[model samples]
Target: MKYPDLFPFSWFKGFRPESNDNLETKSPLRQLADIISSSVDQIDATFKDRGQKYPNLDAPFDPTTPAEATALSPEVIHCSSLIVAACAHLSATVNIPTKLLFDVGGGFHLSAALGVIIEGNVVEILHDHPSGLGVYDISAKNGMEPTRLARLLRLLATHHVFIETSPNVFKNNKLSSMLDTHKSFDTIQSKPEDKYVGTSGISALFAHTCDEVMKGSAFLTETLTDPDIGASGAVEDCPLAVAFKFKKSFWEWLEEPRNEYRMNRFMLAMEGSAKLEPSDAILRGYQWGNLPPQSLVVDVGGSLGHIVREIRNAYPGLKYVVQDRPAVIESARQIWEKAIPSISDGSVVLQVHDFLKPQPILDARIFLCRGVIHDYSYSVAKLILRNLRDAATENTELLIIDTITPYACLDDNQARVGYGIMGTETLPPPTPLLANLGKANAVPYILDSQVLVVLNGEERTIGSFTELLKDSGWKITRVFTISGSSGKQILAAPV
Candidate 1:
C-alpha cells in the first residue's frame, strides 16, 4: 500500500550518485592517497607510451584525458556507487533496515577521509603517509611539528578539499564532509563531535570491491578455473565458466580473507547490499495492482529475509517467507532480531531447505525467486524448478525472477549477471588450444574438463534457459522486465 520510492537509479545522472542533500565539505586524509595514486598512474601510462624522452613535460596535465579517469577507473572513485551495489547484497543477506547504516557509512567514509586532508593540508601527504594514520590525523595528535607546514599546505591545496574563502579559509561541499569529525569548513579548530565520519556507505563493501580484484571483476574466476581439469589439461571448454566466472570466484574469495581487516570489510560490503529491493528495480516499474493482493510470496535462497520483508511491505495483506541454507537461516534469525524492518505490517517466515533437495510445501499464492535460479547449473537450476513445480498447487503461481539474456547478438554485448548467492563455476583450462580438448558447444556432449571452483555458478541466456526448462518440463508463458533496464521476468507453466 505504501511503497517508498521502490526504484531510484538514473543512468545518465552523469557520475556517481550523490545525495541531493549536500554535505559540508572538508578535505580528508584519504584524498591524498586518491590523488597520489591518480598522478602515478597518469605518469606511468604517459611514460610507457611516449618513451624515454619527456617531451618538454611542459603542462604537467594533459588536457585531453580526464585527470581522474586516467588516474583510476571510475569504479574506484565511485565509492557511493559501491554502496548502492553492496546494499543489494546485504538486503539479500541480512534484510533491509540496515540500508541506512550502509548509506551513512559510505557518505561518511567520503566525508571524514576528505576532511582530514583539508585541515592538515594535502601537499605533504602526497610525499608520505605516516604510521597508523591516513592523510588526516598525521599532524593532528602533534600539529605541524615534524611534518613541515609548506609541504603539508601544498599537499592540502593540491587535494582541493576546500576552495580558499580568503587565504587559508576554505569553502565547504559534499566532498568536504570528509574533513571534520563534526562541523564548520575552514574552521580548523578541532575535530567535530560526530567522530570517525559517523559511518555510512564507506563501510565494508567499499573495501571489498575496491581492494580485491576477485570481488570486483573475474580475475579469481578466471584464475581458479582450469578449463582442463582433466589430466592433459585440454578440453572443449566450458561456456558457463567463461560466461559467469567473474561473480562466482568473488564470493569464493569473500569467504576467505587474509586478515580481520579484509574479513570485516568483505562482510560489511555484502551486508550492505542484501535488501528486499530487487537488483533490477523491476518491482518499481510494474504494477502489482492487478493481482488480488496475493496471500504471500515465498523467496527461495532468500538471505536475511530482506526480500520477504520488502515484498510484505509492498503488498499490505500479503506475507512472506525466506528459504535458505541452515547456516544462512541462523544468520537471518540473528539480523532480524537485532535491527529494524524495511517495511511494516508484512510478516516474514523463515524456511531452511537445501535447494539441491526439495522445496518445502506452503500455501503461498506466489513462489518467487530473485537472482536465485541463476546460481545453479542448468541441471541444478532445472532441479530447483522441478522442486518448486512439485510443491506448487494449481492456485499457486510460480514466478522466476532473474536477468534474461536476449537471443539477439550485439557486437559488444555484455553477459547477464549470475544470481550471486550460492553456486560454483568450473575453472578455465590451462590453455584454450590444448584444454578445449573435446567438449562441443551444445549439449549431449559431455565435458572432458569441468571442475567446480566453488559456490560461483553459471549465467544463462533466454534461449539457453528455454531449452533447459523444456528438458525440465516447464514452459515459459510471459516475460517481464524492469522498464527494460536491469531486471528480468518469466511466467511459467508445468508440463
Candidate 2:
C-alpha cells in the first residue's frame, strides 16, 4: 500500500510488533523510538507526582488491564492523548531529515514575512511583478535588510511560499499569493485613516492564530501552575490573561480601541471557522420548514448576524431577531444593511442586549445560540441558560450549536462504571486501533484545551450538557450531527 509522502514514517504503513533486539540499537528509527519511550516515561512520572494536586485528574493507568476495558477520567485521558500526539509528531520530525529544523526556521521566517507583507503590501507587489524582483530592490522597497530578507525568502521557498528561481530573484506561489490584499478598501472594516490594512479572511485568521494565539500558548504551563489562577473559573483569570497580564477578560480586552485591528482579525477568524465548519447544520438538521410562516426566532449573542442571515436565506418566511452587545449590534446592523437588505424591513432585527441580563424577548418560537456558551465558564453558562429559560414559554425551543466532546472509552458501560453520572457513551473503533480513536479525535481534544487557556471555559460531554441543562430548567431532547462537521446541534426545551 502506498502512503502520502507528507507522512513518510514506515510505522504508518502497517502496525508491527517491536522487536526487543532493536531497543539496544542506535539506528535513527531506534533512536526515535527510544526518545518517545523516554518522553512517555517522564510524562508518566510527572503525572504520578502531580496526580494528587489535581484530584479531578487522578485516573490511574492500569497496564494489567486492556486499554479498551480500563476507565479514565476525561482530564487524564485528554492529557494521555496529547502525549501520544506529541510522540507521533516527534517520530515524524526525527524520521524526516531536516524536517524539524525546517519547520522551526520556517515559522520564524514566515512570521517575519507576514509582518512585512501586511504592512508593505509585498504580496500585492509580487502579484503585479510575477517575473520576480531582485532581493535588494524588494528589501529596499519594504524597508528591510537585503541579505536577511533574501535569506528569509529563500527559506520560505523551501516550503513553496515563494520561488527563488536564481541567486537573488523571488516570486510568489499560490500559498504566498493569498496574503495579498485584493479588496478595494484601504483599511480594515473600511474605517477611514485606519493604519491597520486589510487582507482576506483566511489570511487574517492565519495571522491572528500564529501571532496572537501561539504567543499566549507559550506560557500555558506557567499560567496553569499559578496559585491565584490555577483553579479559578473566572474568564479574567485564564491562561491568556495570565500570559498577557491583563485585568480584563479576553472579550473586554478585544473591545479596547487599541486592539481594533486584532479584534477585526479575531472576527475574521471566526467567520473563516464558520465557513469551514457546518454553519448550515442547524438550519438543515432542525425542522425549520415545519414552523408556521412568520414565526419568530431569536438569535442569542449572534455575531454580525452571519448564522441568522444564512437561516433567513434558506427559510425566507421566518423572521429573526439578533441580540448582542450594543457595539456588536451596531456593527451587525451596518453589516446587515450592506449584505442583508431584509434587515431594514425587520425581517432581520438587530437588538442591543447582553445575554447575561434577563432576555427581553419573550415567547419566541426558537432561541438559538451558536458558538456562544462555550466561551463561558459553567457559572456564566448557567446564567446565560437561565436567562433564556426565564424568557422562554412552553412552546419555545432552545438550540445550542457547539462541539460535543466524546469519551475515550470503548463502550458506555465502562464509561458509566468509571465516571458514573459524568460519563457519556463512546463508540468503539475498528480492531487493532485504540478504543479512543487515537489521532482521529486530536482536533477536538486540542480545542478543549484552547477554551481552557483562553477563557477558563470548556467543551462539554453529552452527560455534562445534560446536567447543565437540567440545572437551568431545561432538558436536552435530541442531538443532531452534520456530515463532515465536528459540531452538533443540541435541541432542548424548558422543563
Candidate 3:
C-alpha cells in the first residue's frame, strides 16, 4: 500500500499564504509559514528525485534503509531544520500565553513518562506484537501497573511516539522504536544489567538523559540561588550534587562500585551520541591524512579510543597514543586488542593518563582532544590546555573537537569569522528567522545548561573558546565545521 506524501499540503492547511510580493512586504508570521511550506516542498522534491519515499511515522525507524539514507543529504537536513524552527516559532507566536506557559511547565511529565517506559522495556515488548498489545498483557510482561501503563502509553501516543491501535492496545512507531535496545525480551529479563552492552546505545542515552540530567535540572533554580555554590565554578559543587546531595564530583561518584552500571551506560551513551552524526564525521574535521608518515597523534580523554580507531583506519601511517582514566584505558585496550592486529605493536599505544595532569608525550605532531574540554570550568579547561601546551613542540597542533556555540541573537563578529583554514563562510538564515537558526542550532545551548547542571562546565561559544585558548598559550589556527558533526573542529598551535 502507498503511504501519503511526507509533508502533505493538508499539513499546512492552517498556515495563511501571503501575496506573491517580495519578502520585505510579508509579515514575520507569514514569512515563517512560507519557510515551512517552501522547506516541505524542497524536501518532497529531493526524495522524489532520489526515487525514494519518505518513511512514514507509523513504521519503525531503520537508519540503514535507503529511504532513511536520503534524509541524511545536506539539502534535506537544511530544509528539515528550517521546517522544525519555523513550526516552533509559528506555534509560539500564535499559542495562548497561559496555555503555552503551562505546557512548557509540564514538559517534565513527558521525560518522566519516557523514563518509565524505557526502564520497563515497553518498546521491546510492543515490538513483538506488531498488531498491538493490550495494556494488561504489556503490564504483565513489563510489570508496570496496567492502568498506569495505559495512561503513559496514551500520553506518548498523543506525542506521536506510539500508536493506540485500539482502546487499550498500543504499538511501537518510528519515534518510539528509536529507544529499542534490539535485545530479546527474555535476554533483558534474564540480565537487566547487560541491557545496554552490545546494543545501539540509544536506550542508554535516553536513560542517562532523562534520569540523571532531568533530575539535576530539577535543582537548577536552587543551585543558582545558593550563595556558596551558586557562583562556584568548581565541579564538586555542580547542580547534580545539589540534587543528589553527593559530596564528591560527578565523575568520582560514577566510579563508585554501586554505580558501575551507571558509568558503563554513560560511556555507551557517549558512544551512542556518534549515531547523531555522519559515520565519518571524525575524518571530516581535521586533515589527518595531510600529516607526514609516522606522525604521532595523542587522543586525550578518548574513552575506548573509538574516534582514533576511525582516524587510524583512514590515515594508517599515523601512530596514536589514546589516553583516559585507568578503567576506560583497560576497556580500550581490550577492544583494540581484538579489533587491530598491531595492538601489541607500538603504533597505537593505550595510555592511562588524566588531562588534569602534566602531559607525557612531548614531541607529538597533533594532540586530539575530542569531547573533553567542554566538561570543565574555564580554569580547569585552561589547565588541560596548558598541560598539552607544555608538552607540545613548536610544530605540534592541537585539535579540539567540540561545539562552538552561536549566539541566539545577531552577532556581526561571528558572521564575519569564517570556519576552516579555507575560510568557508556560514550561511545565515533568511530574515525573520533567528540568527543562530533558532531551534536548528539549539543543541549547544541545551547542552550548555546540561553540562552546567552536571559538571559545572559548559558548551563554549567561539569567543569563549578563543579567549580560553589564548590564555593557555595557544592560538586558533583554523576551524572545520564538518557536515553532520556534533561540533566544529578548532585547530590550534602553540603561540
RMSD of each: 17.9, 13.2, 4.7
Q: What's the ranking of the predictions by TM-score, best on top?
A: 3, 2, 1
Model 1 whole-model lDDT (C-alpha atoms): 0.43
User: Each candidate: what lDDT?
Assistant: 0.43, 0.66, 0.82
Model 3 CA lDDT for position 232: 82
Off by over 4 Å in 2: 1-137, 146-180, 183-199, 277-282, 337-347, 405-442, 484-486
Q: Between prediction 1 and prediction 3, which has the larger TM-score?
A: 3
For model 3, residues 335-428, the per-residue Cα lDDT tens digits are: 8888786878788999999888999899899999988899988988999999999999999999998877776776666566543333324545
lDDT of 2: 0.66
Using TM-score as the measure, the top candidate is 3
Error of 1 at 308 (Å): 1.7
Candidate 2 local Cα displacement, residue 218, angstroms: 2.6
Candidate 2, residues 159-194: lDDT per residue as tens digits? 567788789888876567656555432333245233
